[model samples]
Target: MTDLPQELRLVTAIPGPKSQALAARKAAAVADGVGTTLSVYAAAAGGGVVVDVDGNSLIDLGSGIAVTTVGNSAPRVVDAVTAQVAAFTHTCFMVTPYDGYVEVAEALNRLTPGDHEKRTALFNSGAEAVENAVKIARAHTKRQAVVAFDHAYHGRTNLTMALTAKSMPYKSGFGPFAPETYRVPASYPYRDGGVSGPEAARTAIDLIEKQVGAGNLAAVIIEPIQGEGGFVEPAPGFLPALVAWCRENGVVFIADEVQTGFARTGDLFACDHEGIVPDLIVTAKGIAGGLPLSAVTGTAEIMNAAHVGGLGGTYGGNPLACAAALAAIETIEADGLVARAREIGELALGRLRKAQESDPRIGDVRGRGGMVAVELVKDAAGTPDPELTKQVAAAAHLRGVIVLTCGTYGNVLRLLPPLSISDELLTTGLEVLESVLAETRA
Candidate 1:
């Protein structure tokens, strides 16, 4: 990783020969359903750059879709995982409980929003964490229905598919989804007729009361800052109001902070911004540096409602992943990554917002901390322009900058640089994006 500098070095064309060859192999061997955003294969990555198979070092603004918050192969994470591997690989926390898992659970209970008596359950993926959260919520509340929001993206499993609102790519042919899941309008400030936060909350609550009815709804799951649905930070006052309503109605409020947790959002958790402590907080993506780990943290009573056997999975808290998570959490706290995320957000958003001033194609620039986005549109009236978004991202990619696209309409370009990234490297990535936007036609 020391050899992999934090600067973008284009030794060859974007994909280069080696990457092109791997792409050919991937075409032949990999499933078509599994799509990749950047075609370049990573040979090594650290700090802010990904050294591709072709030896072209690309500036990473996507942070592996918000997973590697401590950067790829971070020292603490690497050391922890290596020591754990040397000690033992897996006993499956279910079969044989481990200290690492318990330590991670303790860390989450302490770090997540609120000073309540909390308990955490570990899982392998964000989807699993969400599923387990819903199970616990239903068990605790003794209700059957759940409510999700517009532009929401929960996961790919049947139950999560029902929770997600997108169609074309995520939920197109994947129907026969879990029943009793309802959808409500999120407080998208930019497009909601200029409704205030309280107003939007009232609108959502009214719909929930009228349509789903709190009596039948066990929980209402939401991403404090929506990820694939675009980095849509709901209007201010919106979250707290909803949390209050949920508390009054005996409905579980689940904060799916899978993308916004663990210092990725310029805070330990996005819910911290509004002081809205959800009943159950589902977290992942940036939890374990680069390891696959997710957790559901909530009040002890709600978490324990699920039967003992209902929560444990074969690899729920794999020793290696738990070790990695503990180290990642340490890095976040010891390194003051919460402040770093704020710094990155200020730098990226300052530059992008400046660029937005001249580019009418950039309809909006929105986010908090390092979790920022540029929403492309056709006109000031804000007709979504997904095609233009693709062109801008492709141009940046060709120039050795790795950016990612999202949104229910696919017109949003999200920038989630690792908190470990240097200011110079992040600025350079944003420069590439600025240039791409300048040249890209609407």
Candidate 2:
């Protein structure tokens, strides 16, 4: 709808004069704590290109951190939101219940993993969904402790901050965080040095048993394909073992699918990859095509444990967001984005692996579907290389490609291109990435 071209076209420098000027104004008007990855301001975005105010079209590989899986300004989402806005904006689902809200809940319940009877509750963000999942778990099991894994990034809220592992930006000085949260080791096959999945699970279980105790644990929350934790795919059998352990111990297993849900990981939910059915699934990001919406879907009995009216927010399931989510869901299903994601993953991973063959600095290449990443290292000894990661990302940005970095050691380059991105554009972005990596390494 915006008349911008779909290709990466650099008419000026990455952060051109207009963007630099706007950045100055932003510094004056916006809080310094609210950081940005790219300094360029978006005028329009769709498909795989983000047209900045300077008329430079940057190939979008991040997809707003995996939020626009259907692509920015998706036709279905735009149409749905337009119609919903024309009809009515919001009446607060809690105050004046609407069909859109119920419809979204139905969709989430039906879509999330598990054939057993389930229920869904809407929230405004991923953090809220995670928080509510913990509350429900505690209420149902009458337990006080929750287990989070190392390198996990739940959210920025007080409780989620406690769950999140990163310390610099997300958790520094943000405490005193909520209590009763414990950290356990996550299965990082690359870093675990031949540790079997079962062994990793046992190590984590031993820590939990010794420190937290099963009776005091209400939930064990994790990202199936750890998101901010460097897209670390646990070793085979890791998740299922944890799920079984939680079930046997009467602790709710919550899959924080906030970044991995909705086909981003080639599965509707990442937990589906291993056929691990969690007691609760927290979803957001890709659920609503850029709309602020999140959900906690779980077994009906566990979700119902919360007292009536114990959960909800003023804008939790805003009608417009519900409409957008429904449309996004339809787009994912009808367009076969799940299979498309796998295709994208194959393309990306193939490129990265080929690059890795020549570059020993690429420590590991891991991920599922569209969510893929390569960890950078300093040498054959495999020391994390954060500086090289930053330099490569900067190089990519200068070349009109949007890239993002992540990892516990800040030495990862993640690729989360939109499923709708064209092969031509996707190839171009990856080419830019390859060139950048080669240049940075040299």
How high is each candidate's TM-score?
Answer: 0.99, 0.99
TM-score of model number 2: 0.99
As a whole number from 0 to 100, the lDDT of residue 424 in candidate 1 is 89
Count of steric clashes across candidates, in order: 0, 0
Error (Å) of candidate 1 at residue 175 is 1.0
lDDT of all the models against the reference? 0.91, 0.94
**1-442 per-residue lDDT for model 1 (tens digits):** 3447788899989889998999999999999999988889989998888999888989988899999988889999999999999999999887878899999999999999999999999999999999999999999999999999999999999999999999979889988999999999998977887898899999999999999899998999999989999899899999999999999999999999999999988889999998989999999889999888999999999999988788888888899999999999999989999999999999988998898888888889999998999999999899999999899899999999989999988999999898889988898888888877877754
Clashes in predicted model 2: 0
Model 2 Cα lDDT, one tens digit per residue, 81-115: 99999999999988999999999999998999989
Q: Candidate 2: misplaced stretches above 4 Å?
A: 1-3
